[model samples]
Target: MTRPFPDDDSATLAAHLRRQAEEHRAKYVRAQSDRADKFVTSPRRVYELIRAGIRRGTMPHDQTLSEQHLIESLGATRNAVRKALQMLAEDGVLVRARRAGTSVVHDIVAVHDGEVGPRAWAGTPDEGRLTVDTLEISRISAPAVLQRLLGADTDSVLLLEQLGRMGGQPLYLRVGYCMTDATAEEFSQLIESNHTEFPPISVVHERLFGSAYGGSDYVVEAISCQERAAELLDMPVGAPVLLRELITRNSAGAPSELSYTHFRADRVAIVGSTLATTAASP
Candidate 1:
C-alpha cells in the first residue's frame, strides 16, 4: 500500500475546534458568576435606585418595567436583571401583579439561616443578632400536619409555639413539635427559668442527643398566611408568606424535630442554591 501524506487541514481544524470549546467554557463560567453576583449584590442597589426614581416621580407607580427595562436601568445584562427581579419578588421587595408587570413596592427583609454558623450577616457577628421579643412558649397538642412531620402519633406529640424576632422586629413565627417525652423535661425547665430567648432547636437537639445535628430534609412553599399567623407577622390576613416545614432526623435517621416557620414577606429572604447535574455517559 502507498503511504499517504498527513492532512494538515484536518489537524488545523481539530485545533480550532478545541480552542472554540475552551473559549465557550470560559464564557459560560464568567456569565454564571456575573449572574450570581447580580443576585448577591446588585439587586439591592437596583432596588434603591428604582425606589428613588419612583419617589422623585421619575418612575410612576403604574409604570411597568419589562425585563429589558430593568436591565437597561441597572446597566446589567438581561439575565442578571431577571435573576435579581426573581429574587426581589421572592423576598417581597417588588410586586409582580398579574397583567401589571413588575413594580417596586417595599424593601424585602433579609433573613439568614444559621445552618453553617452565623457568617451570613455581612461578616459581622453583631449583624447576626436574633432579637427575641414577644416570645411566648406554650405547650399544645400537635396538629395533624405537625404530627406527620414528627413521624409520631398525634397524641404522642407536643407543639411549642414561639414568635421570634431579629433586631426587635418580628421576623418569623415558628411552631415546633417533638415527642412529648423527648422535650417535656427541658420544656419545663425552660419555663421555670423564664428563658425568653432559646437557642435554635437544632442546638438543643445536639445538646440532648450528644451528637451534632445536621439540617433537615425540608420543603418550602408559599402560602396565604392564616389569620393568626398573619397577625403575628403584621401582614394582612391571607397575605402571602413563605412557609418552611422541616423534618429533622438524627444520625440514626430518626425524626427528632419538626419545625414549621412562617416568615414575614417583608422581613425575610431565604437564600438557596441549585446544583448543576451532568448527564450520564452511554
Candidate 2:
C-alpha cells in the first residue's frame, strides 16, 4: 500500500488552503468597495397592500379579517397577517377586539417604512443601522430540505442572497428561500429592483403573502465553512463559522420562508436580551 503523500503533507495542505481563503477574501472585499449606499429593512409593502384594500373598499370599514381568510387571500401565514393588523391598529387603520376579532377601524392610514419599530421586522434596533448589499438572486427547483421545511407543493422557489455590512466592513451573509407559484414574478422583480434595500425574509413574507410580519424560529450551530459558504462569507474554507437557520412561520404555525445565514467567526458576535421572571409564590 503506497501512501498518498509524506506524513507532513497534511500540514502543508492545510497551510495552502488557509492562504487561498485569505487571498479570496481580500479580492472580494476590494472589488465591492465601490458599491453604492445601502438601506435598512422594512415591511412597507405589506402595510401598503392592506391599506390599499381598505381605501379601495375591497376590505370595507368594520369588516373583520379572519386568520384563515388572510392566509388564503394573501398567501401569508397567520402570524404575519396578525402583525400587519396590529401595526394597522396602532396607526388607527384597524382595530382588534377580544370578542369581535380584527376589524377595520378606518378606511385609510398611511404607514410608512420607517415609522414602524424594530419588532415589526424581527430585528433589533442596532440591526436597523447595518447596510445591506444584494449579492445574488435565482430561481431553482426546491430542494428536498426546503420542500420539507416550507411544506411547499410546488417544485420551484426563489432564492435571495445578501451581505450585511457596517462602516463598510462585511459582517454576515444571508440566504433566503420561498416557494414559487403566484408570487414568483413579483419576487423576481423585487429582487431585481431592490436587492440591497429589500426587507428581510420575514417582512418579505408579509408583503408577498399579505400576512403579518411574524418572527422566525432559529436553529444555531457552529460549523466549518464549506466552499460555497466560505466564498459567500469571504472566510477560508474549513474555517469555523456560525450558521443560523431560520424558519419564518405565520400565526397558524405554517412556514412561509426558509433562510440560512452564515457569519464569519472573526467579524460577528451574538448577543440577546431576556426578561427577568419573578419568583412564583409558595
Candidate 3:
C-alpha cells in the first residue's frame, strides 16, 4: 500500500507569505516618509520652524527628529543634508540629544563667518554682540595627526590651542601650528596683550605676513566628540562634532599655518548666503 500525502496548498502558502512581506515593506516606507517630512524643507527653514514650534510648545518636548528626517523631508541627498545639519548643530542652533534626536536649542548663540579684511569686526564691539572671547592659549607639542596639517617636522612645530567662547559658553576649540618662530612669537605676544578678546587669526596672520592668509587647501570631516571636546562643549562623549583642517599659505604659496577647528554641535548655526534671480532680458 502506498502512503497518502497530506494536503499542502503550496501556492496559497506562498501567496500569504508574499502578502505579509509587502505589508511590512509598506509600513516601513510610510514610517520613513513621515519622519522625513518633519525635517526636509530648506535646512535653515526646517531649523527655524522647529525653533518656533518649540517656543510655541507645538513640538512635543519628548519627541524629536534626526538629521535623516531633515534630509528626507527636503528631498535632498543624504550627504548634503547631513552636512547642513552638522554645520548648524556645530554652530549651536540645534541640540542633539544622545539616542533621543535633534532639537532646537532655546538659548541664543550665533557663529559669524566674515571675510578677513578691514571691516570684518565693524559694528560689533560688545561681548554678546561679537561672541569673540579667547578662552585658552597654550604651547604644547603637536600631535602626530596635527603635525601632518602643519607640513613641518613633528619635532619642531609649535602647537597653540585656542578655545573661544560666546556668551560665556564654549564656541570652538582650535589647534594652530606653525614652524615660523616669528609667527609663534608674535602669536604669543598677541595672546598676552589681549587676554580677554580674540581677534580673528586670519587678521593676525595678515599683520605678521603683510598679506591676508590664502584660502585653506584642506578638508572638513565629521567625527564623534572626544572626551576633552565633550567636556569643553558641555556635551557627552561620542556626540557628533565637526572637524575642520585648514592649511594656510603665504603670498608666495609656502605653507604658513596649519589649524584644526572643532566646533560644538548644539549651540550654533553656520549661515551662508547666495544670490539668485530670474533674468528679465532673456
TM-score of each: 0.52, 0.46, 0.51
The lDDT values for all models are 0.62, 0.63, 0.58
Candidates, ranked, lDDT: 2, 1, 3
Which candidate, 2 or 3, would have the higher TM-score against the true structure?
3
Residue 7 lDDT, candidate 1, scale 0-100 = 59
RMSD of each: 12.2, 26.2, 10.4
Residue pairs in clash, model 2? 74-209, 78-251, 79-250, 79-251, 80-211, 80-212, 80-213, 81-211, 81-212
Model 2 bad stretches (over 4 Å): 1-129, 180-185, 188-204, 274-282
Cα-based lDDT at residue 164, candidate 3 = 64
Superposed by TM-score, candidate 2 places the C-alpha of residue 178 at a distance from the truth, in angstroms, of: 1.0
Query: Tens-digit lDDT track for model 1 on 2-29?
Result: 4243455687778878999999999999
Query: So what's the TM-score on candidate 1?
Result: 0.52
lDDT of 1: 0.62
**Model 2: per-residue lDDT, tens digit, 1-282?**
876556779987788779999999998887655321221113354566776787556887678888677655765555666677777786655779898899876443221221121121325333444566667777888878678777766688778787765435455778878654546567666554433344655555666656765655676689998997777666779988777777776756766678887766543444334689999999
Evaluated with TM-score, which candidate comes out highest?
1
lDDT tens per residue, model 3, 140-159: 66678666656656555556
lDDT of 3 at 226: 95
| Model 3 lowest lDDT segment of ten | 111-120
TM-score of 2: 0.46
